[model samples]
Target: MHELVSWGRVRLLGEAGVQAGNDATTPAVKITVLGSGYVGLVAAAGFADAGHQVQCIDIDVARVEKLRRGEVPFFEPGLREVMSRAIRGGRLTFGTEINAGHRASEVYFIAVGTPPLADGSADVSAVYAAAKTIREVAEAPAVVGIKSTVPVGTCDAVQAIVDEGARVPLRVASIPEFLKEGTALADFMKPDRIILGVADGEAERVLRDLYRPLQLSSERILVMDRCSSELSKYAANAMLASRISFMNELSRLCDAIGADIHAIRRAVGSDRRIGPQFLYAGPGFGGSCFPKDVSALAYQARQAGVPLEVVEAAGRANEAQRVYVRDRALSMLGGEVAGKVVAVWGVAFKAETDDVRETPALPLIRALVEKGAEVHIHDPEAADNFVRSYGLPVRCFENEYEAATGADLLVVMTEWRHLRNPDFPRLRTLMRTPNLFDARNIWTTFELGKSGFRYLGVGTRST
Candidate 1:
């Protein structure tokens, strides 16, 4: 562990800066990431960790104040340590204001969220909001890059917006960001490849230089037009979703055929092309990305007169998986939900972060209520946000024991750090019924069985 910290810290100094030959085609430059949410904060820290100056700008004064205090507002393993190191080293700086950050930066990356609307289309208002601010502020010569996941032709629309408002000719660039919440810092520090989209020269070179630290010996930079890069973000999520939905559908069959998802995944992923990531069967994939991106893509396609049938199906499957898990939890209690007190731990989707934008827990909680079950919930950091989103109906608990106390069953939705190795004995004592619903299957399923508890897991019976 010490060696890992040392090695990682060494890489933090740009020790392995032997960028691949392909990067020679484009030049390197400085970066400013707008909107210090999940993507911007992690990306800024990663760049700063690699010995680069990054200005992280956001409109939220409270969040900026918290970050200034060395307090990362949410849970992210190792993020605080890395951000602290970078901030102290004078490589990463934060501000609620945008002008000071944008003017000094040679390349601007927009990492704001493109939330889904009530009709399921992406609400690109935030994306446009940032673009408008950048156009009004950017000093001297600069390339305005879109790091937010946007619909096709959004780049063109933003380009016009900037051109109309700018004193100088600011070239609009699209360098879509692809990152998972849990592994965001690592992924940004050492990306699989860097994608840079530009209308003409200079922008590509600037982006390539900004990410030169991660291009070591891989030539992992793909340069494309602005529109293609914008769509690539959605395409990537669509494909990853298909993989999850595929496995989720197969998990149902595995039960019928008496075949196990674990064994089947091993056999399938052995192909090298299939790769082992995202193959694990679980409640479903939910977070700020997959659900919204696919829904936006489907909406984008429909509005463009092109139908994304596969993406639409994948969205439906994801919704079903969430409902399926809750239903299965109820089924474990013999399909009787009335007067049932069900304890649920981990409301934030797939932990290491406190983002509950589209967490499966929302619908699952609703379902529990509709079935007449009194749901008791607990999460590490998202409880407050969850309560604000939907309250009075759900009884939020302070601790896991309190959540499980007098409960007919315990459902583990998110795989939080503390929840991994819980006191099973004490938990059993607290619960009215010791039914363990392991949606994530973090612990040994057989151990759950031997614990003198009724264990219901997502996939096959664990040994």
Candidate 2:
């Protein structure tokens, strides 16, 4: 695979086991990944791919065994092969125990998930639990790297957790990932920026030495205080999520008036100011990061006596976007939702990821089922997860057309790589009627015109 060789130069890139030149990087630390879920596994695999002596630790033995066998438990495009090669080559090792890992590792990265809670805050119990384990067994003076998307005071909280029971000083730093799930390896090796929040003396040199590869490439590595680093990650996601919500609001406007959003987007993007990224309208934003991180930030902000009105508004807008798409689908089907056969193209939150934690398709599927529609769904990697979660109220299709066969309508939820281009001839044959719902507005109105399908795109005005 291209991924295997592409990452061979990885030891020359980011902060795992980067090559050294100037008076540093002598005796690079043993990097350890704590957790084996999407973020944890990917981070672990990437560092191992980077030629670092990486030991991946998780509580789940099945997950660990899967990694050890080169069979990735999830569907990340380049992850499986790369992890497999590394595991085969003895650069990467997987274990279920945490204490042995802590004793052996020099840089312990905590990449566990921070699922949301009822109190509208991030439940960071997993992170604290990991720290408690590290405190009990670690023999080495380690820099605890937090690669998780945590709340603002999280690194500080982790520091307190470790320090409270720790015999030696357990330094904690935030190195939050900006990776889109499927493209994690690419993002990790060639990131736009690398964030490091550390206290002045002890951890700085270790961090600087570790990240010499990125410095060579001249990528911006922002070195800030630990708290700022933690907040920066949530703030970054909030801004991106807000942009999606903002455009979805405009999408509704485009539907109302006789305005094509594609034209407007082109016109607006032509200016140097707005740059046309995250500008497309969709069936609301979903996936693992946006909803959880934004809500977590909002909660943290409220606790600090400053409610994030704008961010909270964006979250509400994203939720409404899903409702808007469902209503539009119902409206296009002449407002009678019962006995409707709706074929949905993509089920994962966003393309290139199997993660459907808060995917729009899940909500829309639930709505379609409630309204008595026979929902047929298709996704590259999310089908199994969807089936496991929802338990087959909707039919899972092997191919896109199979899902579309005899359907009254089609809803394109996630913008998968292949779904951007479709076989209109086959699509027409499969459908009961020629109604298409373009939630991502991927297909042009001109293309739809030539195809002779009654199209309902998210932002574009109906001609």
Candidate 3:
């Protein structure tokens, strides 16, 4: 059996926000996922792992070929193993198009990317294209669940397109994804809550049956209107971003008053009202979700003439934090680091994933290069993606030891687990001058002063 026993009812109580219930498994159904990006691939693999026959379609021919060999293009923890198992068991497959063979699937999931446009609005052309293809090729009646992050009313708009085009009866639902990058597979396998935006009972029943395996232990699924479900995703991301910005702003005040943010965060977060999740005061929030969602939410509000002042302020604060981190690092080197060799540790936005969409490290690295500092960067998995995004001239190292060698300063951008406890003695001996900037505040307990190193931490200026 491909049953993943790791997700138990005990772990699902607070995290999944549901009480333990009786087991209710449904018959396995054929599923097709449009797009092979983060959301599509994870959803496909996760469904297949849950005993569903899943077919994932993508336009990228090369990417499909790679997956056929049980190789994942991006870095996500535990996804490759699950996907390989599903493929070897003949339950999961990939292709470049949705043809006659795929029409037998009862449910189709649209998990394509909705990239932001110049005005911060989500360019949903890819979503529309996927919908158009589904409308043209679906031979049998199917429920199309949109797992893409889209603006409000997107589901209704796509439904209208399918209504006018499709010959067979079709139902459309908005099922926005809440999977975090690093733990996307886990997030999908065991979600906090499954939001199903359906117009009628038929669509609801279809999705509920498809998700019976996940809901067996607890019924955490929530059924709501399409527009509300669409807005819920944006609101959740904005709220999380606001929390980070609020903490970051407080961290600045803490620095000015000679108070430690670490202490304040603990005291404040201990309250039941404000639990400690995204409350860490760091170099600000980054990755694929927060930045884009915040911008999109703010833009949507402004377009409607009811500006989201709180979200807008959060965006400004986040941008300011980025600038502050960059300037602080430069100041440590006597305010002019034109000829210094600075080593950057952890380039991915966060740990456990290789997604560097809007990572704060990009701005710092770009500024360093512009100021003539020789940048030596290293990440366990994201260096190649980073280099591909910004083709700036810099030294990319395979190992942290190589990157930190002969460096005047070392900046920790992402809080990778392995980066928390490093060979400080070796790093001290390798570099010309020992200056450590902990942007993620992962080393708050470390005593760098006694070890002959100048340590700088975000929101806590000691050791």
| TM-score per model over all chains | 0.87, 0.92, 0.94
Between prediction 2 and prediction 3, which has the larger TM-score? 3
Tens-place lDDT digits, model 1, residues 1-463 = 0011110011122323222221434322346788888888888877777666667888889999998888887667789999998777666778877645347466677889788898888888888888888778866567788888888888888888887757555678888887778788877777776788888766666666667667665788899998888888889999999899888878767756777788888899888978988887778889889999999999989988999899999999888888888788778777788899988898887887777877877777887898898988999788888888777377887788888899998888899889888999998788898888888877643587777788867667632
Query: In model 2, which regions exceed 4 Å deviation?
Result: 1-25, 99-102
Better of 1 and 2 by TM-score: 2
Per-residue lDDT over 340-386 for candidate 3, one digit per residue giving the tens place of the 0 to 100 score = 99999988989888888989999999999999999999999999999
Cα error, candidate 2, residue 228 (Å) = 0.5
Worst 10 residues of 2 by lDDT: 1-10
Candidate 3: clashing pairs of residues: none
Model 3, 394: alpha-carbon shift in Å? 1.6
What order do you get sorting by lDDT, best first? 3, 2, 1
Worst 10 residues of 1 by lDDT: 1-10
The per-residue C-alpha lDDT of model 2 at residue 322 equals 86
Q: State the C-alpha lDDT per candidate.
A: 0.78, 0.79, 0.86
Worst 10 residues of 3 by lDDT: 1-10
